[model samples]
Every structure is written in C-alpha cells, then in structure tokens.
Target: MDIPRSFRKTLLAHLPYAVNEDFTAADDLAALGLNSMGLVQLLTDLEETFGLELPDELITEETFATAGSLWATVSELVPAGQFSDA
Candidate 1:
C-alpha cells in the first residue's frame, strides 16, 4: 500500500535531521536521527492522528525501521474507507 500523505507529514515532523534529505520509503529512519524518544513521540502522534491504537504485537523495531514498514502497519489499522491522500 502507498503511504498516506498525512502519515508522511507526521513522520517527517519527527525526523529532524532528515527534513532536507530526499528520504524514501527504504531509508533508515534511525540513521536519519529517529532516536528512542523520537520513536515514542512519533508513535503517539501517529496514533492520535490516525485515531487508532497500535496493538502491542505491532510495536516492533522492524515496524519502525523504515517509512515503508511503518506505513504498512498504519495502513493495516486504518479503518476501511477512511483512508485518503490528505
């Protein structure tokens, strides 16, 4: 699935160092400066923005490893018919 624009905006906001880079879905977020604290904040932001609670099982390092992985997780949780480019 494609990453939602809102999701990208939220992800970019947490990645301070990556703002100027041409980051892609496969880019390593950690290398882009997404530390532990940033990850937590990102999680909270994503949850609140998407209006969905991430299940414990879904909270894994792999899930947040890259933008694509994170988007995959969010796409799975977003309510059907509610997803939009915005």
Candidate 2:
C-alpha cells in the first residue's frame, strides 16, 4: 500500500484506526475501528491536505469506503484550476 507520501501521512494521522492496505473502495471504514469522532477529524485533515471544500455529496459511504477511495476522491476534488492555492 505504498501511496503518495502526503496521502499516507494524512491517512495515518487522521484515520489512526485504518491501515494503509485497506485501499479498496468497499472496505468498511468503521470496521477499521473508526468512530464518528475520528471520521470528522479525518475529513478536516483531508480537506486541509487537498485544499478543497468537499460537499457531503462526495463524502458518502460509497465514495469514502477505503483509503484508496478517499485519496482518489480528494485528488479529484482538488482545485485543478489552481494547485498553488491548494
């Protein structure tokens, strides 16, 4: 589960309960041992890392089921028009 350093660090820091290998988009995020409190922190860290204000529409269970999926969604939501700002 070697991924971008930033993603890996962010995942480890935020989703402390989740492991790096849970890269699929169907893995239970909660099964990884996350609680509702941790999920909020993870979202905040992800938003800060990617520089995108993610709407709940993209934060659904289907979209954030795993580490890889979370990284993909963040990469996709990142402001393509301005990387510097991000």
Best by TM-score: 1
Q: How would you encode candidate 2's per-residue C-alpha lDDT over 40-84 as one tens digit per residue?
A: 888898777677788988877766667667767777777654333
Count clashing pairs, candidate 1.
Answer: 0
lDDT of 1 by residue, 1-86 (tens): 36666777888888888864357889888988899999999999988988999999999999999988988888889898656773
Candidate lDDT values, in order: 0.84, 0.65
Worst 10 residues of 2 by lDDT: 77-86
lDDT of 2 at 9: 64
Question: Model 2: what TM-score?
Answer: 0.67
TM-score for all predictions?
0.88, 0.67
The local lDDT score (0 to 100) that residue 43 gets in candidate 1 is 90
